[model samples]
Target: MKLPLHERIRSEIETAILSGTLRPGARLPTEHELMQRYDCSRMTVNKALSALAVAGLVDRNKRAGSSVAQPKVHSMVLDIPDLEQEVVRRGQRYRFQLSGREVKQPDPDYPEELQLAGNSDLLRLEGVHFADDRPLACERRLISLAAVPDIAAQMFDKISPGAWLLEHVPWTEAETRIAAVAADRTIAARLELPIGSACLSIERRTWRGADGITLVHQHFVGTAYDLVARFGPAKGSTGAEPQQL
Candidate 1:
């Protein structure tokens, strides 16, 4: 479906923000400039700018115009176990501290970006994933108790939901994507990092066969860790091992 004019503009602006093209405090073009660039009406431009303003991306003043918002540096990651384990195997012990957890009704104002629809009852887990006793990642996860009944009684301070699920529940499918973002005040405080620090964010959805999606895990990793992927030919084939960045 085609997005509304305002939404399209909002998405374009968001892309620019996420990609580092829009640095904080960099003034954006005047309303006329944006209208001409987007070939849309002034209302469309206003709506886009308003949406960005709500997201804390830019500051619009009567004479100052719009400027590139400071990029928040939150870490992004994917649920690739090998990489997570490798970080710990390198003599760095990984630990997770439970920041908060509860079951709540989905917020009506929740952004569609989460893709969590019609989910009134969700088990939420918020925590920080650490390496060598230092902050490594901050995570907020939503688990469907109806799908994973035992989750309500499980211990999470020790084993992560992702790891625990991998052991007890065999997942048949999953999808994930990574994005870089600047840390907001809330996340910055929990991760004990400076506001506007860069961090990697991961969004993942897991499914156990045809039983529908089981859980959605979100991660905000520190800038230190890198997410890497490897691929190869058949076992008998001759090829060099993938290089690590």
Candidate 2:
């Protein structure tokens, strides 16, 4: 189905911004220029830019015209579900235990995904979560000290890292990636599963504005639990239909 002319224009510019074709602080084409390029009316161009500004993807001003905005925190609603609630919903008792905690500088060999310099300090946490006395998942997390200054002082053994971060930090954006892998010896022992057993792995990273907040890797016993997400269009909008995963 064809989108409205204004919506098509809006999507084109948004794609450029998100894809790094139009970087932060890059000036957008003037309304007159866009009208001429797309052969659309000025009102149509205005509508597209207005929508981008409202969405926090662009800045608009009479003096400076339009420019790509600083990266706002992007979030996926599927990332913040409570594991304890999920366990209870399945009629199992939930338990969490912290195995280790430390504060250290980022290693030079650290992966690029964390977006940190070698000198930056991080708070590292290792733990396991259980259902009915059986291990359900193993968690390893690293929190940026610059993003959450007091993170090292928190008692994550009493409150889970996820819960503590949700309560204390204001994240602007998050990303989650899910995959499957065979359990290695370390993970097998932690989750109380057989070596080479299939497992579900989730890698999640979150940020507050442009500052990296935390990165977590969770390995769940595959056969005992499933991950799910549901989505639907907003009210009064002719958007995509409801779907589940």
Candidate 3:
């Protein structure tokens, strides 16, 4: 299906802002530039920019033109965590050991595995994070090849996938889910814990605009690990968005 011209323009700009290419308060392209780029009428470009203003993603000024808007709220927020930083910040040494790596389609035979990039082929990885030479977390991740082609060449031997991605990728949005669960046999052996020991399980997904980037699951020994983050409120968050926990 063909997208409307104004929608396409809006999506392109939104993707830039979300991916950090267009930071807050950055000047947007002039109407003349947009018209020349998209080969559209001024009205079409104006419609697209107006939609962005309404959504609070941009601020329009008659004299200064349009610029990316400031965040809408100041409430506390939690963010996707980097396990290596978590350990190193506590004055412990950190290392990652890769157990498996493959390029495969989404959805394997194992129901326990998850890949949320729809039909995109994924760079699947499995590894363990060690803090001061003790197993700290077991990680299973799927990177969307469509979204980050450069990742396929990474050797991940000297770094964890999460850390590498944090440095190299720009993500628009992310979702995290937390659960307390009994360690399954696979995770128990990997983390060197008795089966059924309590563990903290976190599953996170990140994206660049509409294209999915990566989904990862990290499991930690509940007695030994903690996840923490500091953040400001999400842009345009309101009573409409989910409450912060």
TM-score of each: 0.56, 0.64, 0.68
Better-scoring candidate (lDDT), 1 or 2: 2
Worst 10 residues of 3 by lDDT: 236-245
Candidate 2 residue-wise lDDT at 232? 38
Please provide, for model 3 over 9-74, each residue's C-alpha lDDT reduced to its tens digit, 9 standing for 90 to 100: 987897788666898899999999999999999999999998788767789999999999886643
For candidate 2, write residues 66-161 as lDDT tens digits: 999975442224446677767776777777899989887776676743474224688888999888888888999988886676676778666788
Over 1-245, each residue of candidate 1 has an lDDT whose tens digit, in order, gives 35678877876776676445766677788999989988999999999898777666778888888886653432332233632455466667777788788876656576431344234366788887777677777777776665566777876867877677656554434567678888889878877888988877777777543333344444454456655554433111112111222
| Better model by TM-score: candidate 1 vs candidate 3 | 3
RMSD of each: 17.2, 12.9, 8.1
- Give the number of the best model, judged by lDDT: 3
Stretches of candidate 1 exceeding 4 Å from the true structure: 1-79, 82-84, 108-120, 212-222, 232-245
Preferred candidate (lDDT higher): 1 or 3: 3
TM-score of 3: 0.68
Clashing pairs in 2: 73-172, 74-173
